[model samples]
Target: MAFRCQRDSYAREFTTSVVACCPAELQTDAGGKKEVLRGFHVVLEDTLLFPEGGGQPDDRGTINDIPVLRVTRRGAQADHFTQTPLSPGSQVQVQVDWERRFDHMQQHSGQHLITAVADHLFGLKTTSWELGRLRSIIELDSPSVTAEQVAAIEQSVNEKIRNRLPVTVRELSLDDPEVEQVRGRGLPDDHAGPIRVITIEGVDSNMCCGTHVSNLSDLQVIKILGTEKGKKNKTNLMFLAGNRVLKWMERSHGTEKALTTLLKCGAEEHVEAVKKLQNSIKLLQKEEPSLLQFHSLTSTWISCLFPLSRKEGDSEFMNIIANEIGSEETLLLLTVGDEKGAGLFLLSGPAEAVETLGPRVAEILEGKGAGKKGRFQGKATKMSRRAEVQALLQDYVSTQSAEE
Candidate 1:
């Protein structure tokens, strides 16, 4: 079936009626693919269901109680594929889901708003648009938009929406003077027949094929999410409109509330609280050496009080003490804790010592680590005994040093 562009000539308020219905029999050819022969027919004096074209999704709704699964253009005719076949000459009422229809209208109209704004404000023409999940994006003939320019354009679009300008759709022949008056040079000159011109009153006028709102106010809001570089000399802009903007705000505020509670701060104080927490962490890191040195003495004196077989909780303290000692000689420090397991640090007299003994110690501890120059650090997953690690380190140091 050949594709036909219908929105250009069709009015926004129209409905389709079923013309014929019959059991569509399937026939297979050489390829064995089933092809339905004249399944059903729909004839509408006019239709509001915009046929799939211009990168827009088709309108969805039930017709004569049968769901319209898909809509396609067949030459000058618009074909509506229904779930169930309808009787021939049945006067079925078509109902378009206005909410869904209006959303597409809002987004399509918003594209015009932004595109027109871009041309007027920056002399850049919008080359294309792709309506997306989070936001609709428009591609401009430029590579980038200055932050200030984007802000100004966004402000202008919202202002237009706020003004509630009447959006008038005019159908004119190719030679219409009104077409020449507001025609965008970028529009193809070869486009034949009547061109649908959407005029935003005194704000904008351009040739468009997609469905649009009757008024600017229908958009409610126009938000510029962001911009990115597209193809050569093209910039893509992401934006949202109406319900999408409201939904985004709701989700964003909910996230902020969750973050505020987790940070233990009020909504307004969240940023400051996060900054303070980061600063406190930095201060503790700087004071770790002195603090660990003091704690090491307590651990040594209370060695009997503590277990000869350390648990996971004690591994962190052991690592701190090892780091505090900061030895120049080859040092192997190991600490075992119940919950956290064991931590091991191997420091070498020279870079060569680590290369020789590091992998061997890792294998003994059932761990993994790699280092160069002078030090190797890693954690053993679950070491049951401190003596096991101590004996392995001693054996490696004695034998390996002798060989060197």
Candidate 2:
């Protein structure tokens, strides 16, 4: 049996009797937090809320004022997941998310038009397609799609939209001869009831079970954004239809304006200005090695930590500075840069002192390390707190001296 949603794509509200309702759990990750939601799996005699299928997401709506979290097709039935349960045989009003539903209709119908036009003009078949939240992709069974082909296909689809082509849907039996004329991959294994076919007046016809707009004018507009290389020598065509195109344009224009302000140049010069800044950065990077230096902190400790403020050097550079200083009786603290920002640190000296103080110094620097014998080495962060490490070593040395 055809659901109310599939029968009338424009219908947003309907009253139906609950066939059954059972305890259910829905796992959700809203706002990046994952949790299992306790809910009811509601089965209505008929539903206007389309389930997740045909590459389109499920419709979000309300059943008797309770938010419908998800909908899935179970054979011939549409299962609506809701937080509250409805009594079996009880009447309830269902409402669909019209904005979301209409957006999907535009994209799905637009795909039909594009696939038809492409096949008619270039014999390029659409292997698959995705109706993404931001944009849609149609994967064509071809190595690459040229700019000229994209422009042509885009022009043709939009022209048909302007022409106000009438889109009609009808259901037929599996053995119906007319079914062979429509374009389709095949019916799903779990598909029940008659096969639904969508046809564009004087354009093309295809078998699809998803909801769609009744007229091409409802699509508003179609924009082929660009193409991407797909796996296995296929070309994925990315596009936007209806409101998505407007949203994309708004975001792109805002980005251009922001770039113009940041670069202090006109829109056209923004590219050159950014390139020049990149070149300047490269030159600075080349001069970074000369910043390294070695020195000692007080007579109580020898410090090889340097290029103290240099951000360009890494741990290997710090190791070289320590090598230059050689072994010594006094405590040694070597760092390529400050841990508060980034870099590496190494501490070496008396065996017992190194063992006791290594972990403490690592904690102070906000980094982890392992040490044994007379040497403690590890990557460190927040090196700006190196003063605390020095103070700790000085106090330990003073304590030992007083004991002796």
Candidate 3:
């Protein structure tokens, strides 16, 4: 089953005879998740839709006005999955998603151009490429690529685009001697039959089965976004081509404008303003802990509850404050709070008071904690009810005095 997309990249729709219509089965994805899609896999004699392969996604469109969810390639045949099944021997109109197909063409061709330039200029070979949803990536067989090298490579690619180089397609036998002429990448071990060669005028010629634009001008433009370190010490270069680059530019300008307005500064002063604002916040946070306060509740009890910016190990700090407040016989309860209405409590001092009153306070505050003979610790919410702690200690003192 020869594919129509391979013969003519611009074929939007074609009436093809359905070879078979098989019922959908549970398909497992890369993550080992099974999904049962309600559709049938309609195999056509010839397909206009390209299947997912070669680091490119599948094309989506329609078959006889029914939405095509996915297209998959199996050996020599391509299957179009749709809800409405087409009868075998019947002819149905198959339409390819033109916008999606052309977008893929632009990025795929852009990748070849960049890959060729990278190899030619800096001896960096393209190990792999992926056509992502938002941007495309090419992994280069290099530990690192400098900024200057990226700028040069991007300049060369855009120059070729502006030159409007004619991109020609050639077919060669897999065993042909011309296979050695491929510059950047190697062929797959399982690849068979005739190899499709994509030639970028005088720039590059490589065996690629993915769709490409007829001319470099169709790419419109190419922009290298950034690079990251990938597996095996390779450099993955991120890029966008044609309309994607324009879309990114629009979004970037919009974000810059929003930032300038928010910071009350000019566009050029945004970085400075943000840095100053961060420093101011750090200064305020540093002064917050100095605002701590202590109060003596009764002869045998003390309360140390203060609102400060929350930090790690706050329980330990509160415990230290409790020990500072009174002797071993005295009852002490220390609490730390934040502006966001969160608090952690620490109780230490007399054995009887801590063992009995500790769990009582925890129950009243709706919190939990644990410690040894004369200490208990835990966290609680509702910092606004801080006054209730003082009243509890006062009542305990009054009861003790009355009993004596």
Candidate 4:
């Protein structure tokens, strides 16, 4: 049995009797917190609100002035989940959200047209699709779709729309031979009643259960945003239809105006200006390594003075020094920030010696750090005690030499 919405997509309001109403709990995100909402599952004798199915979402509507949060199909019945309960056998006025319903109709029917055109023009079969909030996507089985193919597909689709192709729906029994001719993945396991097939006159026919526009011209316009790489061996084609295209244009124009003001250039020069700015940034990054260099200490170990701002911490400079002068044969006791007061220190040397002496150095320097393998580092509040930390490391080196 077809629901009222499925039979007539334009139906906005209707009166129906509640066949059953049962308690249902819905978990919803309220102010970013997940909370369970108590509601009721209402089964109407006939409904104008479409239940969620296919690649489309459920329709928003009201039953007796109470909001219907969700609708789901169970077997052949459409279950309207609402916060307020209606009495069984009581007649209630139901009203569909026409704005939301019409937007969905445009996108749903638009998908059929695109899918058909893509399949006929190119052998790209739509494995799956999503009707996202702002845009819709059709995932094709191929790994990539070139710009040329997308342009041709878009052109052909719009041409058919201009031709004003009639979009019609028909129901056939499960055993009907015509069912074999309609394109579909296969019927759902719980599917009941006759199978529904949507056809665009002289274009293509597909077996789908979602509500759609009555004609191709009702789509207004379709804008193929671009293609994105999907899961391995799949390509997702993103697009906007009807009012969504206008919404996207409005947003894009606002962004363009903002960019023009920030860049001090016209829209035509924005790309070149951005490219030049990016190149300047890349050139600056190339000179960053010159910030540190190896200075020979009395023990022939490497030392470096950090001249960068305090906000730019010493970790990257210290790593660059360590990488340049391998720590196996020499020790690196590096300090950053003020020379006589608070600062940061890093002590890198032989693993065994560092593991044994790193913490003691941190203690003298009045900071904490952990070490693995051959590196120990931490902040130092008492950088005035740097002499003591140096003495400790020198003593360890002297003792090791004496033993050798």
Each prediction's total of clashing residue pairs, residues at least 3 apart in sequence or on different chains, is 7, 6, 0, 0
> Which of the numbered candidates is closest to the native, going by highest lDDT?
4
The C-alpha stretches of model 2 lying farther than 4 A from their native spots are 30-33, 287-404
lDDT of each: 0.65, 0.83, 0.78, 0.84
Q: Which stretches of candidate 1 lie over 4 Å from their true place?
A: 1-16, 20-45, 184-193, 269-404
Q: How do all the candidates rank in terms of lDDT, highest first?
A: 4, 2, 3, 1
Sliding window of 10 residues with minimal summed lDDT for model 3: 303-312
Model 3 accuracy (lDDT, Cα): 0.78
Q: What's the residue-level lDDT of 125 in candidate 4? A: 97
Q: After superposition, how far is residue 96 of candidate 1 from its true place, in Å?
A: 1.2
Residue 236 in candidate 3 has what lDDT? 97
Which lDDT tens digits does candidate 1 get at residues 1-404? Answer: 11122342223233445554434333325477665544444544445566665656777666765666556555555667664776655566676766777777788889889988888998978877887756899998887888898999999999998898998877777677777787554444334456777889988887776678888898999889889989888899889998889989999999998998787678898887677656545544655665566457555532111112333223334434345543444443544445346554343334575677667667766777777765665666645544565676567666655666
Residues 63-104, candidate 4: write the lDDT tens digits: 999999999999999889898888999999999999999999
**Which is better, 3 or 4, measured by TM-score?**
4
TM-score (all chains, Cα) for each model: 0.60, 0.70, 0.69, 0.70
Off by over 4 Å in 4: 30-32, 282-404
Runs of candidate 3 exceeding 4 Å displacement = 26-34, 183-192, 290-404
Worst 10 residues of 2 by lDDT: 300-309
**What are the candidates' C-alpha RMSDs?**
14.3, 13.4, 12.9, 14.3
